[model samples]
Target: MDSISSRIEKVNPSLTLAVTNQAKAMAARGEEVYGLAGGEPELDTPDHIKAAAIVALQEGRTKYTASGGIPELREGLAAKLAADNDLEYEPKQICVTAGAKMACFNAILAVVEEGDEVIIPSPYWVSYPEMVRLAGGTPVIVDTLESDGWKMTPEQFEAAMTPATKMVILNSPSNPTGAVYSEEELRAIGEVALYEDIVILSDEIYEKLVYGETKHVSIASLSQELYDLTITVNGFSKAYSMTGWRLGYTAAPPAIAEAIIKIQSHSVSNATTFAQFGGVAALEGDQTFITDMREEYDGRRQFMLARLQAIHNVRVVEPKGAFYFFVRTGDIGLKSQNLCDKLLSRYKVAAIPGVAFGYDDGIRLSYCTTLDILNEGLTRFEQFCREH
Candidate 1:
């Protein structure tokens, strides 16, 4: 057989999926296992959103649509962006994508070139660095301090920049750490991007999942200049519990949006047709369900944090948003992968190793599972730590 493309060699399999799959394999063999590795919400999609998809399917809306998306969904997304994020855009500037992950990848490929440098904060989502690599860009990682809440400061951003810098990827309510950037913090970083003339790919998929007094702010909404240089990515996955629907959208300048459309026209084309209808309903329907889900996640976050705190020698930064807690395992004298392996093999508790997300000092656990499962899994984790 001929050798595969070199670009494929640069990509790494997802560490999160690795841990989850191992746990599943063990369960199939009749061993007890609890998975705390996935990022998807456990709740079912709201009825109104499902009903919209059903109505669309019954009306024969399953055929192909425009490469960008149906006009209705584009308009709905523009309205939602303006109302919620305070960022204005026309339907022409929005592109519906297969998921927020695709939106981010498309944006990176649309603007980044070979030999270009893309700055990503440390403890990032697993896919960010790989996506940059597949686009032929160098992933310049800037580490965020745990004492500073695992957020990138302007000084750190300045240090990471070089003349080859092409883009900066920002994920608020970060997947691994769940740290959110404040408006002041975002503005400081925004100023540097403006001065350096670099683009910002802002991933706000978890915007509506924030808890308590922590508010979600869009960096693009901070100023017109920032909006002009930003491609804002969001979707129905976290907020609407619609991961299976695979609907996400990006709001960008017209030129960048056209570039993304060109890529999609030859790629997967549009997001699912009936799924787009569900997306519209997700945005326009009653939002009370979102509030209820947020409250539930808040309770879970508190419960998980308290449990982890009771475990001696483990260090955890309380996550402000998202459903994850990235706990440092350095005190236990094991690398992240070894700790995760021990927890899964000996303790039957599954969590993602931090090395998968470009950090090696910690492992990530998702609190999206049931409380009873969390109690049992966490208790086993505590026991394992003590025994080792």
Candidate 2:
């Protein structure tokens, strides 16, 4: 038995999956659990998207197409970006990936060399630092103050940058926090990146999932130069209820895109064929499903935020978009993992400990579940807070 690779050794198992697995194990033992740990939407895929997959299967579009993606799907994704974000990209500049996760990883591996730093904003998506570590890069995390709605300042970005800086990763409509960056804030960050010649990996998977009229501004849309430097990653998972389909795409410089395709060529080849057809429909089909999902998520966000706020000593940001509330409970006099374990074992509700997101005093709850289930889970958490 040879030694395991240090790259894998340096990483911890996904904390999100760890909690969800424990909840599942408990359920198998007959304990009821409402899982707020998983990030996928509970809704079923729309009929039209499913129909597209069926059509593809019947039409014998089952073999491997291009490694990056089907030509039509790639062109449609590029056109969608051009029309929606005011960013122009040819199909060659786009790479459709297995999922947004792979899109991000491919982009990082393509452009970042080992020992380079990937600037991550704290309370970040669970995978950012871990992936950077796997890529043999230093993860430079910049903290975003609670006062600024969890957005990093230009000064913070500057402080994190160094001679070895390669890329800065940002998630608008952030996964754990649901904070959307306003145009002014993003523009400030962009200016700093431009002056420094640092690349930006803007993960905008939740672009269509924003709430209350908040518009998502892509940094690439601001200038041709920024577009050349920014790799904007998005997918059908959050917005189209297609997480299981495993389809994601990125718009990047053609050179970077080609580099990622080289990486993809040796790993997993291409995404599922039928899933790409479904992705085509998702991009071109009716957008009403997206609107409806956003409306529903807004309602769930309100309910969960209000309930969490009622718990004494708990600090939760009112999220503007996405379906999560990263609630800080250090004030409750317990470490976050202990608190989450108590809630899961005692109250049978599952949430990810904030330590998973680099904040040990809080826990994260997803509002993507059914309203009844969400409200019940909230009640259980509130009761746990009252008891503590």
Candidate 3:
């Protein structure tokens, strides 16, 4: 007997994890694999943040606190939002979860339901459509153009809306493409969502990783109307290099925040107790770690962009933020999966296929690793491109 629920059956396992795990297994067996498929920063979490968690543990703060989050962390997040993103969210309007991923899932479960249509731009983070499907919502994928820097225009969002449309998932400094939407672009999209009464899920996990002159703008901060319509999700995984800590939060309007807290109470109970203290330190402690990480990622981004452009038959837009580069490999004449397979199996380099991100003509290469690994990976990748 097959007894899996329909929602579970509809979900696809994360292709990013599949590739990264395969690469890890091969490396464990002494294989030389240049792994570029990961999403987390290679940098270490700051000593201060870790010390805070250790202090919490010493003080026996491991007991479960509020279902949404501890009061201290929630208050810290409120202050951070107001000072950094210019979004004024009270502590009660926040729901901290295991990760930004869970925060997104909880928001979807709270607001989306059967027959609801969620407009998600293509080349999205792989989990968006899956989460919508799990929530019994129809995911309307709007294929975005590379010429538009893989961002969905307001016109496209308007064209995709229906009476059944309930939400739109917007990722700035997107995971696969690293497309950071401008304030004007965000305002235009927010206007459409406001007019249509569609909810907005703004994923800003990569907010602190932006580079060059590209500024990260929170759509929810554009206006009070957008703020009311948006649920903002962020976490410590990227910026703080705290992926294993499992701490993230959602800031939403009162009703939605209450709903998210209710769902979380019945599910995960809350983010880990001591870890939330680390989250407090992350918000309030010295922020120089972020600046240092951003500078290093920028240097790597420039180097990778130059090397990729020099390679034959490969095209990549310089990513404005985030560490991944979505590279067009259609000129190589094989689809993304087959191309990535050959790279991993033969060339000893692992990269995620673009098919995972809803774009099959390309692949995603993460530049968060060391320059030596990147140099070797690009060398092998360039060879594969030449031979293919």
- Number of the top TM-score candidate: 3
**How do the residues 191-297 of candidate 3 rate in per-residue lDDT, one tens digit apiece?**
89999889999999999999988999999998888989999999999999999999999999999999999999999999999999999999889999999999999
Residue 298, model 3: lDDT of 93
Candidate 2 lDDT over 304-338, as tens digits, reads: 87788778879887888788898888888889889
Higher-lDDT candidate of 1 and 3: 3
The candidate that wins on lDDT is 3
After best superposition, candidate 1 residue 370: deviation in angstroms?
Answer: 0.8
Please write out the lDDT profile of model 1 over residues 94-162, one tens digit for every residue: 999999999999999999999999999989999999999999999999988899999999999999999
Which TM-score value belongs to model 3?
0.99
Ten-residue stretch with the least lDDT total in model 3: 35-44
TM-score of each: 0.98, 0.98, 0.99
Clashing residue pairs for model 3: none
Cand. 3 Cα-lDDT? 0.94
Off by over 4 Å in 3: none
Candidate 2: regions farther than 4 A off: none
Each model's lDDT = 0.92, 0.89, 0.94
